[model samples]
Target: MHLHYLGHLPPDDPLDGYLRFDIAPQLGVHRTPSGFRVFQFDFCRDVYLYEELGGAFRVVGKFFPPGRRMAPGLVRPPTETEFQNLTYLHRLGLNNGSFRITRPLGYNPWLHCVLVVDHFDGQPLGEVIHQAIRQDRRNRLFRKLSALAEFLAVLHNRTAGDWTVDFSHPYDYNGRLIESLVEKRGMARSEAEEFYHLRENWRARTCMWEDRRVLVHGDATPSNFKVGPGREVMVFDLERMAWADRVFDLGRLAGELKHFFLQETGDPWAAEPFIGHFLWEYCGYFPDRRDAFRSITRRIPYYLGITLLRIARNAWVDWNYRRRLLEEAKQNLRAIP
Candidate 1:
């Protein structure tokens, strides 16, 4: 994480007086060897912690990126509304339900930056999934999935709205997926046209989906979630949260589940059972499970294709695998009915 070093611990601190006083007890007497004063946040955000004169650790400060580096040289800065939206989303997460999340303590909008939140401690779901699995671990995983589904249901129910796509859309969220397929993934013109045609067909087919527009955890990769002792799930990285089709999240998760299992066993088939179980658990939240299950089944393939295409654009994926992802996306689009 590239952090903008505002100041040192004691004197050079640019923090507001109230924040400084709040964290004064937790400020260490000295800095680390590398002059590093903060803990691991994320690539685009800066997270600062205060380990008290005693030993307790608490997150006191966070600086969100004015601009994010998308490609090697491309930097995208968020608008004022976009930045404020993130803080509001975090507040919503902190206030809602049995789901665990970083508690929003405060916000500093002077530079249109800085959000303060309480640090949360838990095992990253990605690491837990990557580890060796036993029967006990499997059962625990199922429990966590159930909790996650319930949590998402709560979030969706709380924030459902008719947010206009072109007006309120902060991220250019869905359009970027199309951009990735063509520009980033290097799909042939004809292939890209066919992909767009298929996407439009699928969209036209399900455009009448009755599910209310709700806040979706736009990025649902395993790394964004953590599981605690009681199998409680905590999610972070809310910059992608948006009011859209909830299926966007469900499909992204399913795509990630498939991707992870495929990477682990080198067999696409290994993901099928887990994917089915996850979808089943998620559908259990709706009163009409059969209708919900059928609706999700119809819609998921489209978003899953979007997820697969997005993954294909990643630089780390080798040529052959990228081709596979593109192929899978096509298969998904073709299967949509």
Candidate 2:
């Protein structure tokens, strides 16, 4: 609810800060205070503006503030790679028609932000899960899940032979993930050590499993996607996109589903059906269904563990629940088939 100004703007007109970019001139600016959010560690500020082009109201200006300084005392800012990832995924979505994503309008280097093609007009999938209407929308849920899985399969198939695997990536990424939980979220050092041990064992067990890499929507939390009429799913925030095992995305989403249900109903089992439905729908696309299912079953536990550990970094969760999540993640790691 509290606002923190990050960008250096002119005292006369804050909106004028963006109009300086040649990409498009802003005719009107409207700030959406309620829409601003913190995704992971990134502090995001949003604004809706009407562009002068064709006098049409479009362009969602997203500002990524330099929340913290990175290595070598350099400020961590939005990179062009993420912008490219957004564009790539948008084009991929348009080509397949399986899903839709916010289009990248342009990137402003000076402002440390980017303008998206549109401001999403639908409720996020996370919100949809909490709505009572979701019970009546079960069929639509399946439709959305099916479409999402198909798109993921398409992406994996298209990039199967294109990317090379880096075995050290998971270790490095997961290490940093746990460290953030411990340092920033006050996770107990003992739990952090346990997670590290689990990671070590998982690395040995999954030596060859992480070899197959695909273009992954690295941050696949429910908040990153929106659901519309007909269960149409539109994804945004591709900043964490990378070439990794597709299971990473699946596991993160599944863990989110589990976490939400556990928090809402105090029973993780309540989410099993939806998680099963998603995985089953995803496996429908594999040519060798049995083998793919086997692999997914065996390997998803590791990714789900990683996702749970990552989820523990959220400050909003109570300390007790966060400990339970860490314990659950450890159990998932130990139960890996």
Candidate 3:
């Protein structure tokens, strides 16, 4: 991973006081940090604060892009939402365990609306997956998948609520993705229309409404999870976290597994065993494993198809590869009947 260090901030920088006064006490560091070493990552900047007394701390800060607006009338901005979500999850006993989230330190609206949280130590699961594929380490991949499945199960099961599942969001999201592909000239109008019909068909499936609403990771991409030395998983990027079908997370992960295998090994079917193992492992956490497996599998195609379309719409992906993703998405949607 490429990381660019921006060097230590000057003494007059406001972040210095924020760290010294606000964050230091929470971390039990008595003295002010001498300086902060800032490193820019793909989506956020990590600041490492060091004190003369040998106290050191790592905190991640994310800034929202200018003109980025939430849905109309939404109360909280992205930074506040993420901070609250992290705090909520931390209070739910996810602060320490095999499955946990990074601790939220504080949000600084004056500092570019930055949302800060404790830094998590581990490798992104995306890199782990790439290594497994390159090294032919199927066992290692399976173990990591198992750990992720367990973590997700605990997250969903522990936070399941009585709220009704909002199936419209997925339908609208899939439609918007198709429209974006058409606008980008990545897909033809006819292809987009056909995908729309497929989405409608998926919406009509009763299985989509069979499960209760649960707190889903909302963005279950491999890059959002960190894997420690013991295969422990720490999921972050909670800005999109919300209540939805538990399979929403699972199917996205399954689709990603398929995408990675196709991109790396040139075989779509190569991911089947790992996907099956992941879903089976997720179901193991529920009371009726057989029933849960059947229900989750039946609903997986919709979210999985949506995930494939989501990836296919990205301009960075090769055109031919995006076409393959579109075809795979169609196949999954068509298999629902």
Q: What tens digits encode model 2's per-residue C-alpha lDDT throughout 1-337?
A: 1234343334345344444343343323343211222122134434344333333344456655445343442244444556787788766654334367776767765665544455566777766666523465656665676767776676676767555566567778789988999789977788788878877877777543555788888888877887677636677777777788778888888888778777777775777777788888788888887778777877777787778877778777788888778877887888755
lDDT of 3 by residue, 69-181 (tens): 76755676788889889999988897676776888889987876778777777888888788878988778888999999998988899998887677888888888888988
User: Which of candidates 1 and 2 reaches a greater TM-score?
Assistant: 2
| RMSD, one per candidate, in order | 5.4, 5.6, 2.2
When sorted by lDDT, best at the front, the candidate numbers are 3, 2, 1
In order of appearance, the predictions have TM-scores of 0.78, 0.79, 0.94
lDDT of 2 at 20: 37
Go through the candidates in order and give the clash count of each. Answer: 1, 0, 0
> What is the lDDT, from 0 to 100, of the residue 58 in candidate 1?
54
User: Which regions of candidate 1 are displaced past 4 Å?
Assistant: 1-10, 16-19, 22-36, 41-50, 65-97, 132-136, 162-175, 207-209
Clashing pairs in 1: 26-52
lDDT tens digits, residues 1-337, model 1? 2234444455344553434453333444343222224444445335566433334445645565545443442233333333455567666654444576655555655633666655567777766666624233565666777777777777776787865222123223344666776786676778877776876676566342556788887788887788787747777666566677887788888888777776666776676776777778888878998888887888787778778878888878988888877787788878867
